[model samples]
Target: MRFRDGQWLVAEGVRIEYAEEVYRITPTPSGKGISLLCPTRKVMSRGDTLNLGTLSIDIEAAFDGVISVETTHWQGAIRRGPDFDLFPAGRPDVDAKITKTEAGTTVSAGGLSATVSGKPHEFDVSFHPTAGGKPLTTLLNRSVGLAYTPAPSSPMQLADTRIFKHYLFTQTTLSVGESIHGLGERFGPFNKVGQKVDLWNSDGGTSSDQAYKNISFWMSSRGYGVFIDTPERVELEIGSERCCRVQTSVEGQRLRWYLIYGPTPRDVLRRYSVLTGAPGRVPSWSFGLWLSTSFTTSYDEETVNTFLSGMKARDIPVEVFHFDCFWLKAFQWCDFEFDKDMFPDPQGQITRLKADGVVKKVCVWTNPYLGQASPVFAEAAAKGYLLKRKNGDVFQWDLWQTGMGIVDFTNPAACAWFVSCLERLFDTGVDCIKTDFGERIPSEDVQWFDSSVDPKRMHNYYTFVYNKLVYETLQKRYGTDEAVLFARSATAGSQRFPLTWGGDCESTPEAMAESLRGGLSLGLSGFAFWSVDIGGFEGYPPPWIYKRWVAFGLLCSHSRLHGSNSYRVPWTVDDDDQSDEGCSATLRKWTHLKARLMPYLFSQAQACVGAGLPLSLRAMCIEFPDDPTAWSLDRQFMLGDSLLVAPVFEEDGTVQFYLPEGSWTNFFTHEVKNGPGWFTETHKFGTLPLYVRPNTLLVLGKEGEKRTVYDYASDVEVRSYYAREGASAILVDNQGNKLGKLEVKNGEVVGSEVLTGEFRITVVNA
Candidate 1:
């Protein structure tokens, strides 16, 4: 929402109200809290009766630590976005005082104060005078007040009649050097400084600027994060509408925002996650590779067995096998019944797979869509649990499937019905669900059973309900910390559902790199666990591409091999000629390596579960804020706080990476290098640059392992790299059930076995 036409004027028909001078200050009690009401006038009023004509703005604490500012005169309209109020919760250790000095009247909160001009009408807010002290990043002029108007009749047209009214807005006065980031799951660029972003979820691919998950929380280069806490649609003009200021406005009257004071970007996310919920810890097995029967790819018992047997023959240890949408009969998804054509005996097949040392966790794909052919469709339609059009008919579309009506998650009865259907699937030996196609919800002419929410707001939030239902159902069946979903779409607070993957990407090197960018961006936006399709999702990737992707995917928090038209099995892509080794060889090498690395990977995952941090960390997120070299690098990522993973994106095996201020050791080759600088190196196809920071202890699982949930403490090989004098490292089990502590003093490994397990320690120098 932009509102400016020029430097000094608001757009035509735009009403402006200014609170120039404070006429009167009175303290009043409302309910349980005390509020301060300050009436401001455009002109000075010497008499008390004249003050009655002025408008009053009420300020009070909404929560224990949050302050709410409301208008007394124009309080009819509902407020929307870009509202910042400074109110600290709990008991303040610092002082708060309103003092009138020669310069102005200042209100201070925790050593931070805003100076209101003493002059009659010239008022502005400024931060501390010194550079090293408290930083005040945002301020509102006297022109700030309640704004209300009609919504835009047209969405696509930029210049609608509503632009002149309250709907379309333009604002200016942004700082020149300010940079912006975090509009959840954005693919174009990691930094969103000058972008015109629309806060709407879509099924756009990695090449375009559009995003699957859109969040209105962004951290500026000036050291503050602005979180627009609204589920509705929000349009943001970040240093775009006006070159100097960030202008954001929504369609409603009530606007609530939080200006998170972060001296650094990491602090901002830490505080933000505290406000919203933090990501939960998923089970260790989820960290291993997951093989899926690609969408639209023909597969039966024979095809499934071949892929499994080929992986085993290649020594690629696969933990979970997912069956795509075709698992159910055509046109009857959510039927939760496996297609007899694919597998005549689903139970017998699952038992056989489990007997082969493969824990059979089948991924049955389902959406909110209920086709007319589905048995539950008529029941939901009759029970008023499906979304309906304005004409009082159930909203049906022929997009993915014929006559598919979306399940109305807003209704409690509808969620129960949906969960019941999934519960039945779980009972029939089905392990997990690929909760797909949540981004295509219709906003217009749609009515939810819960009429309290706006239709447009529910569009993005629909994924939350859809994933939550399936996740909760699984948790109830399997217990907490064991539930997972290979979800596609998401919004704020959706990280509670453990695992989400990059949706529908093409089979190209460019798409592969973009997919990594999307996952990194999503990880930065507060999602802890994420994965992308190994090879690709749309077409058959070449053997070289597939083999390279296998290494990358296996390293992810969750790994899956999926595709659209062609099979993703290693044998299908490997060349038949003698010049190249079989696809089975490529799969065996990476899969076996992933299995061996499970102890180290799962240990890092346990830390992610304990702390609300990402397993796959972006460079800046883990490195020092003062390190200038780390700010721009995006191609590589730190696997956790300890190790840095630089995947080879090009055909040639050359890789470039930077190590921040420490002696680092290569995890694969055991080569040590002194860092705090950049390094470029070449490698073979089997190995990439994976380095561990100095004074670090890594627990490597035994060679040729099978499962992620093993005795991590037993037979664990602890490799201690560049351990300085008096330095120590600790390794804990998956549930934090066992502790393995090793200490290094004077360049010697002083190992102490804290718990019962088989372990070995390797000490290396930089």
Candidate 2:
């Protein structure tokens, strides 16, 4: 997308038009706004028709705002993509008319205005009325905007282009100290200033740069977020383009983006979530540790029993037990029928687990792919519910399953067929579905039921339909606040589906950290709840890695122990008889701690569901923006607004963490630390640094309430930490439905509300 050769000149065959002066400015008929007409050339002849050509320039506004500029030529045809802005119109608060004087033209919004100097084909758009604390005006430079002629013989590409096809681009100037962040579920470095990113959703594993969820939005260190309002592909050349600018371009003629003006990154996300709906509240038990049968692992009734017995013997409370893909007979995934060969008595097995005080929630793996052996495949194919080739044959591929054809979710009948299958699983004891694999959709030579829509766009959009169908099915079968999907892929608005997991990561510490980065990025993108394989998803994690990941995973919105080619039983992976020290003891320690902390963790999850906030919060999102230390720290994350969790990423359990501008109390050790600085410490496998922020009331559930779905407010203990003068804290129930509010004045707990739980307050001296 970068077109400039250097600072002085444009590349060959490029045309540049500079707006030298504003010829005229007139108020619209509505009197709400005014448009500035700038002529590119300077000439003085009476009645001379001025056609100075099109202007190539950059345009931007404060975050949570929008800017519109038009560049049209007589020759090129205007191509448009899917129409957006279907919801509502934004209102402009500040306005000033553009006035053209002999010197220049000036138009204003807010207290800010720009003046174009009167010169022949040379003008600079500079901020005007440089008085007071007016909002900054963005200058459009040469490299920031451009218009391109399409190649003469390239075939027309639409929604289904695998990656980006042809694109017209513009690069925005980047400041030397500026950094980029937030592109949704990216596994790369949290800061994206120097990266080349493509806005396409893929099923690529967690080890690679490819992401299952790709968002065309990014907030800059300069305090603004730019979100391209397109479902189609967008290419972002972040600092990669001209070294000083972030360049972005789409394929079509029309380009529209919203500049979300947040004085802080958290405010930007809050505004963005308001535009796109915020995440709904999930159930409390969804926060507890979930144990799953790893994909392709040899597991049956006896194997499941052994793992459950071992976990209990070790006192590791498992809330949900998941059965992966093999629960169904091979090649008949969507049938929703349990494999009688493996579980001769399905009901008995479920009943046994339920009786064991374990909430049995089977993780049934499914995709849009319907194998030929599937019972509903014939029905779907007969009703034209399958994606078809150009020649009208059902599109079939042998990727995961033989002769697998994707269910055409666009068709109402197809969605019904898919839902019917899930309803049957719900009818069986299956409480949840691990809705996997919407990433490898075929975009080329495919025909959707909605023929007018492009397939490339459908690739990501496909997950929307896929997840919605499953989620809606569960909601219809169960009820509201009960439907959740372990969805693997998503696009814009896909946050409507409650829970999604970081897909298929390798069993390594690097993969574990990468998964956290992806989840953090995804959280910023609008997804509220996320999970990762506790021991990673691919190979067996070493004991140290497993125990560390267990602590990290249990703190996430959802936690599941899953893997491939190996069983995830702690004893199997970390056996004392082997050379390495077993993580079985470590797992036993943290798992019980997580279970004990369930009262606090579930409350945090409820808060996320209610406020559309992320359960695992990045330090920058919660800390003061002026604290430079918060921006660079990503290895550790705040569990909620109160608790800071620094996960041990290394073998020796060393963690370097920062406390932002406060007196913090360590949750495990009753020690207090005054901060606004960095601290490096080492600990045994038994514990890590889990700190509570000053002036906070954290609720702890009563003992023996092993399940997360208990009446949290009934027997909750409120632990008050470091309540500074004039500070207050509130303890919410498992639903984020407020339970009690507490305040501190003169270093004492005050403003206590009626409490139904066994609550206590601890005020630490600063």
Candidate 3:
């Protein structure tokens, strides 16, 4: 994807040409539109026009508040099927106004205005914020083009694409001092300014550059966001391939990009979420801890009971109990039936677990892959419910399971067949399903149910369709507010399904840091809730590493205990370790803290669902973009716009984190510090750098409550920090009822209505 070696030279064996001259412009018959014959060379008299279908540009403000720029090469090619449903599907049609002047033609849509460079030197499509004072942002000045490799005369040459090697690419400048922030689940760094991110979802673990969820979108520090409206492998060179430009390329004839405007980065995400769908309302109890019988580890009904009983005996509360892969018989995955050997009476066991009071929520792992040994595989093949190749054969693979055929969610009958499996699980007392392995979709010569679908596009968009089927399945059965899934794969709009987790992280400090970065990046990308493996998914973690990660996991929007070869139960691992002398005690401490704070967490989550506030679980940069220092700090994050958390990533529990321009109050010690700078501190396993920003109000349940589900308004405490004039907070209970409001005037905290539920209030440095 990197074409340039430096500022002045292109890489070896690489050839790229850009659009230069505009020959003619034709208007669309329906709306205000202009299509230009933009070739790769300057048209001087008629001698320079030899090659055709090299490049063309279409400029239109088809939808209100959206500017659509489509650049094409090899025009009039047959279109493939699996493209993203962009602004056209969900928004109203607004007539764009075109005004021609000597300067250029301006197409105005709402407050956004686009000026196309005209006549003598046809070059740019520049945009301005006419409504606000925000500066200009350009889509492409002269960077739209086709890039390809010439067939080599040398023997070392390799074939690139079966179709013509030409691909569509566009580049736009990033202003001086501007920071770019997304391309989802990127674990390498916080600022994506100098990163080459290929939007390919792969199973390469968290230690590498590969990501599980690759959404082709980015938000800028300049108060706007850009979404490349294509699902075919979008290669993003953010100030990396070519300096000062975010170069986006896709392997296709046409490329579509949406330029979204907002006065702030948070507002940009708010508008972006409207283009795609917003996050759904997750269940209130999903905020509590989840314990799983780790993948590849042996487990049965006795093992499940012991894990549940162990947490209860230690006073560590768990809400969701997850059964990993072996819950179904080995190699017969997605049988949708619990292994009779492990669970003799599956329905009875689920009913017992829910009634036992220790574990009230239950989940099972399910993927779309149907194994050959499964009872329903033959039936599915007979019914044509499996994905097929162009040769009319089932595309079976032997990677995770022997002879596994993928379910074609795109087929309506296949979806009903898959939904029936889920209904069978729900017929028992299963509460949730962890939708996994949708990322390893095929991009070969595979045929989809929709005959016009493109395989390359479905490689990423497959997860969206897979997750949507199950999310709708749950919403239809359980109602909108009660549905949730512990999903492991996603795309641009897949955030509509709540609660996705970072997949396959190792048990190390470096992986822990990357997991946090991935979560923060996903939050900024538009997801409301996320989680990761508690200790990790790989090998057994060191005692100190396990203890540190537990604290970090408990603070995420969702929490689950899982691993690959080892169980993540604190006491089980602590039995053989020398480090983390208080491992069990530390796990208990954090679990109890998350349970008591469910009132505060659930309140913020509900508000985000009702009003489109871009998910409360956020990176500090998204919450405090005004502070330049916060833009580059990836090790820490701000929860719900008020609480700041710096997870200790070292074995000794020492971290250096920034507190952006505020009087930050530590959540544990209630110690207030004035910042806009960095602080270095060492903490025990029980404490990390969690802070509450100045002039905010936090509603918390009772300090020592053991159960996760409770009347949040009852016996609650409202904590006020640096409460000054005009600073106010409203308390909403778990059931979406307004409890009371708190206001501060002249450095005194006052209740608006003598707060009916849990009148206990604490003021910190007010």
Candidate 4:
């Protein structure tokens, strides 16, 4: 954390010792082996043996182009732990080379270099553009420090003994113009320069700085990413403390971080996806609009039917129907059995719903919690499948429900028990699992099935194993491309599970903007696909808020309409517009608009999987990194490299956004604008600022398609907006099956690649 109060003085009781001298360096392999000694004080005489605060550091390479820097104070301290699922390169052949000279040693791979100094007395790693470059740019900047503060001076501890905690920290330098971003799905601000982020997942709502998903990976504008490899609590100050360095501290003797070198932000993301895992391809139909049964609201099969029928009556295409927690009885949550009172013929009703004119997928809510009243709770507890206290009792608490016990995902049999529960729902026509509530995992005196891992270490990491078990079950039953989870909590590699949503936002415009900020922050953190409750998640959204959010929701990678305690259906919550059918009509329009754009959106999803790009959804900086103005633009985002979507975030409908150096054409209107400047405009709830990039051919589905799951090539149209003479685009359908390539060459069109579908070209006046 922060040691100094402001700039000059250290806090009263805080004791800090920084690495003062580099003792020696023992060098080994090309990219793998190295060690250094960093003393807390200069070694002038042998009297220094009394208090040796010397830190031992091990530097090595992982995978192809990644570095692991581990610093330790007490080598034998017992607190080691649960790390994220990192995929290291299995000794691949590359151009990486490490050599030692008279002064020090150097390691170079691809276009990156890290230099280590021996005689210069520095335990730091200095990174630069080239091995011989004089302009020493960004590098890991801090000395390994040992910190101790007397455990709070309360009366409870005054009588017993003196106490202190051992902490270690490291800070990395930020270049002059560097802007720090990403630590997880944060809501406060996009540029994390002035933020103090804690990498601990919480159940806090989206309206605050507290995040449901807290990832330890942060990427900088200087084009490198750092991952703090700890599942326990980690605090980072991104320029808030020092105003220059990104300082990191964890509550243990050991400190480990992964330093990723990317010359570009995109390159850094690709490298990050390789280190963690890439997200799988979500099924084609999942790109459509989804509607959910609001939590704590009264609902059953009849309620679901009415919601679906209302959508059909208004011609709003809904692809997935979700059942929230009350789908099971109140206190019997996570029993994996549907409430028979509300849904007597669960399987039959689901079958009928799927048999409708529009194909629909069913998603049911699930958590790792087992209430004591649940029929399966005793079975799970008896089988040693629940988290236990140090005294061998099941760790039960009265939090969300009575005597709730967390499923011990560390045990294979426990996971198997959870998987069987999910399989029962899958047998009843359930297609996706809304994996919720993994942020409240216990870190106290608890025991795990795999006793080797400390419970403290599994606090944030518990979500990974929990989500993976359910996701693997989905992948096993359905194919790889068909599995999806609307997960709310995640770690670094949790992006491997597709489609996480922003959690518990209120029904207001500010909350909507906060969700956008969280989603963009998550994108920067390497989450592949993200969704938000269309009308916010907490209360009754105003009609205009719902309609405006509808445009933004439909255009995202995944869209859903959900709320906290009220129905999010258009007609039900439109109090201000009761005199008209405006909400229903607007929902119908935006819902079908997403269906028509399925050809373009699904192709982008395929690119996320096939290429290193995990989420085609991007922050503006990801696309326009060279533009200095784009790094700070968080309100607007590039929707899959082509369309720039700036969702109107206020009730007054006023909009102000930037277009970074492009010829942008309005998607709804044919108006074109020259960018590299700011624009202010006002519009009603029916529209938003969805601008298509210049010179790109939009591969679109046929107009008025009832469902989104059709063969994208059947009646596709490649529409061009201000087509440049040499600009071309590859056209693909919802399944990413190549239809053809459209090019404007030599002032004339040429070539045909479409095999079975009817293809046509239309030009829109820009």
Cα-based TM-score, every candidate: 0.87, 0.87, 0.94, 0.94
Report the C-alpha displacement of residue 713, candidate 3, in angstroms. 1.7
* RMSD values, in order shown: 5.1, 4.7, 3.1, 3.1
lDDT per residue for candidate 1 within 307-371, as digits (tens), equals 88877765667778888888888898756778898889987887788788755466678888877
Model 2 lDDT tens row, 293-351: 88998889988888888887766677778888888889976566788999898778887
Winner by TM-score between candidate 4 and candidate 1: 4
lDDT of all predictions: 0.67, 0.69, 0.81, 0.80
Scanning candidate 4 in windows of ten residues, the lowest lDDT window is 134-143
Clashing pairs in 2: 63-260, 63-261, 64-259, 64-260, 64-261, 159-456, 159-457, 160-456, 174-244
Candidate closest to the true structure, highest lDDT = 3
User: After superposition, which runs of candidate 3 have C-alpha atoms over 4 Å from their true positions?
Assistant: 3-15, 24-33, 46-54, 62-65, 87-89, 92-95, 131-136, 139-141, 151-163, 576-581, 610-617, 737-740, 745-754
Per-residue accuracy of model 3 over 130-176 as CA lDDT, tens digit each: 56564557756457887665523442332335533656788888899
Q: Is candidate 2 or candidate 3 better by TM-score?
A: 3
Badly placed stretches (over 4 Å) of model 2 are 1-139, 143-166, 576-582, 609-611, 703-705, 751-753
Error of 4 at 614 (Å): 5.8
Report how far off residue 367 is in candidate 2 (Å). Answer: 1.1
